[model samples]
Target: MTGRATPRSGALFERAQSVTPGGVNSPVRAFSAVGGTPRFIRSARGAWLTDVDGHEYVDLICSWGPMLLGHAHPEVLEAINEAVARGTSYGTPTEPEVLLAEEIVARTPVEKVRFVSSGTEATMSAIRLARGFTGRDVVIKFAGCYHGHVDALLASAGSGLATLAVPGTPGVPASAAGETIVLPYNDRAAVTAAFAEHGDRIACLITEATPGNMGVVPPEPGFNGFLAQTCRDHGALFISDEVMTGFRATREGGWGLDGAVEGWTPDLMTFGKVMGGGFPAAAFGGRADVMGRLAPEGPVYQAGTLSGNPIATTAGLATLRLATPEVYAALSATADTIIGAVVDALTAAGVPHAVQRAGTMFSVFFRDGAVSDFAGASTQDTAAFAAFFHAMLDAGVYLPPSAFESWFVSAAHDERAVATVLDALPIAAQAAAKASA
Candidate 1:
């Protein structure tokens, strides 16, 4: 499999390198951590990707968690097609944006949602609103939480940063990074301690509702509730970043798994991924009063030219409309089957491993024991994962190229797709077992 040909992808890589940095737009897409030619996808539909080289693979990446219904869902395509015929971006108010916002408000705890072009913008604007509303300068974020490349939030992000083994990227200014306090994920004492000292000056504390970047590290029971209470006690905002987990993880996102059960809600929440239906749309929302701080209302001042592009809004609205209870049930069942198979395969190969899950999202860590923090997640055997990754690819299964990221599945991942992954596991697991640290 390692000797298999990838001339088309390889040639494209060389051509791209001459133009783009690292031959990819996103750092992880370069496959630097996994050591392989990144497959340039020619087309994707219903859990399968056809590469430029004409090789087909079951797509477990799901476009990094956005393809909830799977690639090229017919209904979603129809909605986008209808939207396109009317207009793409009007740079003015549209009905799709209004309907999308209403749909979001109905599903989650948000009262008013402001649309954005990407997850980065959603989080960035939420952070600014937190600062402006509270009149504070400092923000606290958990280590290993990747809330996009927003300057202040990138202080100790995971995902691409973890894959590349970089402590933090170099371009962020000292002053920008300095304002952010990085805390360990799932550590209550650290949360208490950080708030104890900086309670008065902290604007907000943002965290992934259920982190998937440094593997799928779910919050410890009562951890999110604790954070909310602490922020409330200090008059600071609690901003939950659900860009990766929203709609894809569950109907109500990560909040449904914990916040709903705990009867707690974040002051502000960010969303993307499945909500966009594979298009570039995201949002931030919370209590109407808190959101009222935005420009056209109070004074926070956030705007985007293509913020609520008609086409993107239509796709998101249609996706959310179709995300029924049955869809969520299928997602859970699919995750259960795949995750169980992964554990069985790794165990059969005598490979020490642990699987972490958050609702429908999950990841495999190449080590033995429960991982609750980034330091623990960092100890995964990259060599073992790289070996397994390539083996799975050879067998026509495309996993997220990094062990630090979650392997996404969709409603489109029918029994056939699951069987494809199951059949490849033993071979990949054996490959992983042979690799040494």
Candidate 2:
């Protein structure tokens, strides 16, 4: 089969660069890593994306994991439509927000919930609440775990300041970064050391329940449980950032995979993506007493003008209600087929790679061994992945543009979608092998 042409997408990209930064709102959408023009999606339905050029491709990104039931799901659309008909935002409390909050509280370990506009807000608020509740200043996070672009959390560890961190980006102040302790993922000893050194001053230790940002690097056995207990021992809050994994990675988010079974729950949890049903909605919540500290209640202040926008909440509530056990089962089955195909194709093509999974979420690393930390994830063959990525794109399969991100599948990824992906993998794997050579 011949490669699909993206002339319209290419033209739009060139035009967009004149006004937008790098021709995209989000950095990854610029396709800097893959060396190609990003596809301008015209519309999406079920598991397929129709680019502006009128080329159709099986969508594997699923809008970075928010389209859990898939794009433009009828029920979700109807709910959103109804909400829009009533009103968009009212600045006053709404029934949808209340109902959504109740649903979230029931599904997860949180006793109280506060709505936010984005995942960044959810995490940012959770961190503030933790600091206020504990009356501490320091925070700890893993190197690979991404907890939004909050100033304090946007930090990188230095050789000299192994436990302490320095600003990872220009805008983040050094003082803000100084309050964070960045450690390697799956490393219990480093976490122990950080706590021992700054136990008294530590406010919280936050992490992705099963990090997907660095290609779905799952926690080692008992790692999350250990972190939870460690925070308890030090009187610090354990905030689980489930912005990507919430509701999508098992019904109770990443907690259902481990914490629910291990008998440990995070002091606070941040959620987005699947919960929002493709809308700009997110939340943070936990023990009622700890959450009681936020605004109009105790001391810490956090508020948003569009905090519980009715449309967003209604969409989220509908998505959550429809994400039944059967939907998760279908998602898992589809993920299993895709993961297996990827491994088989890569192995057959003699391409060195490792596939890591956390429930339904997973990623393929162009390396031989398992990836447990960001350091390990960084060692992937990006040149090879770039080759494979373009090959898949050419073959009408839309994958996440970057190698260091999770490949998502939705319940809507039926047989046809899976078949499209499966057919593309072998060719893409061969491309990767050639690049490696």
Candidate 3:
């Protein structure tokens, strides 16, 4: 697939900007970091995205962590089509929603669930539930682990907001911000200190199982277990914000961190991305006792008109069904291939860098040594990354526009797509080297 912009794409972006903010639905799509007009995607299939110019490039960002099976997979499309024939939003209960919920509970092994429209909604609702469940106001979150735009959790979010370099938005009331305490990721001591000071009134400690916002920072040996233990000791609820890491990290929704990571579970879990299958579907669940306290049974008020829309649930169900063990193996293998190739290319080019990986997710950090915390991740050479990003784009490749976001690998990223990335790396590396110099 060649990455050439069609005149139509350029025209679309120009027109879009007049109406939409930054000429894109999301911020990073504007290619602000890379310094170019964003490509207008006409359609996507399998591992490739076709721009309006009739150009195709291997997709590495994977729609920012959904489209695990790739865009418009026949199976997923069929599921979506069938669901649409039955009518769209019901604003009430649907059988597909029940089945999807059942599938999620069975797979993630959560006791109960509440569906929401987006990852933001799922996490925002989870935070409210956490506060209600624990009867506390303070929330503990890591600096780089983004849990959507939920005011309290936005202390230091990743993704587009990170690329824009905003600490936190201005509209959030200082009173709301006061309840949030941002701690450095992968630093056990920071967590300890926060709990020591505000353990009593702390309702929940929300965090990503593996920090993806700051380029995929995995827990440093037993850190997650420590959080679980700390929450238990302090009478706080551990809320795992797996909106990004959910099914993308593993079939069990980053809970693999608990078992493979020291054998413990958080009191609440939020999920989105892969579960949505490229649509707006997300959920939060945990202990039955806690989830039971959500609505008719309890007092925490949270509702959405399209919470469990049939099409979204069907797409989610189809996506989850395809993420079997075999699919996960393919995803891991592809991620390893792309990341390993990038690492080798950078080393050969003598570019200073480090790469982080968690399951099928990875990121290239343009910094020396490891990035263990938000401060450390921030040390990445953004100027250099911006140059390399455009170079890769020119070379018919798509990378996460910012140095702070994780690159997703899907089962659809076959050896051919991985090979295309490997081919593009040398150019990207050279670009990074010059930009750094």
Q: Which candidate is the best by lDDT?
A: 2
Structural similarity to truth (TM-score) of each candidate: 0.97, 0.99, 0.95
Give per-residue CA lDDT, model 1, range 1-437, as digits (tens).
Answer: 46358899999999999999999999999999899799998999999999999998999989999998999999999999998999778889999999999999998999999999999999999999999999998888888899999988878543321111123678987678877888889888877877877789889999999999999998999999999999999999999999999987889999999999989999999999888888899999999999998989999899999998899989999999998999989999999999999999999999989998888899999999999999999998999999999999999999989989998988899888899999999999999999953
- Which residue runs does candidate 2 get wrong by more than 4 Å? 1-3, 160-162
Residues 1-437 of candidate 3 have per-residue lDDT tens digits of 13454689789988998999888887877878667778888888888888888877888899999988888889999999988988988787999889889988887757898899898898889889888888888887877788888877666432421111124778876666777777767777767777777788889888898889889888888888889899999999898888888888888867775644566888899999888888899999999998987888999989988898888999999999988899888888888778788889889888999998888888889999988888898888998898788778777778888888899877777778778888889988888888899
RMSD (CA, Å), each prediction: 3.2, 1.2, 3.7
Please tell me which model should have the higher lDDT, number 2 or number 3. 2
Alpha-carbon deviation at 369 in model 3, angstroms: 0.4
lDDT of each: 0.90, 0.92, 0.83
Q: On TM-score, who's better, 1 or 3?
A: 1
The runs of at least 3 residues in candidate 3 whose Cα sits more than 4 Å from the true structure, single-residue gaps closed, are 1-6, 156-167
Clash pairs detected, candidate 3: none
Q: List the residue pairs that clash in candidate 2.
A: none
Q: Write down the worst ten-residue block by lDDT for model 3.
A: 157-166
For candidate 3, give the lDDT of residue 191.
74
What order do you get sorting by lDDT, best first? 2, 1, 3
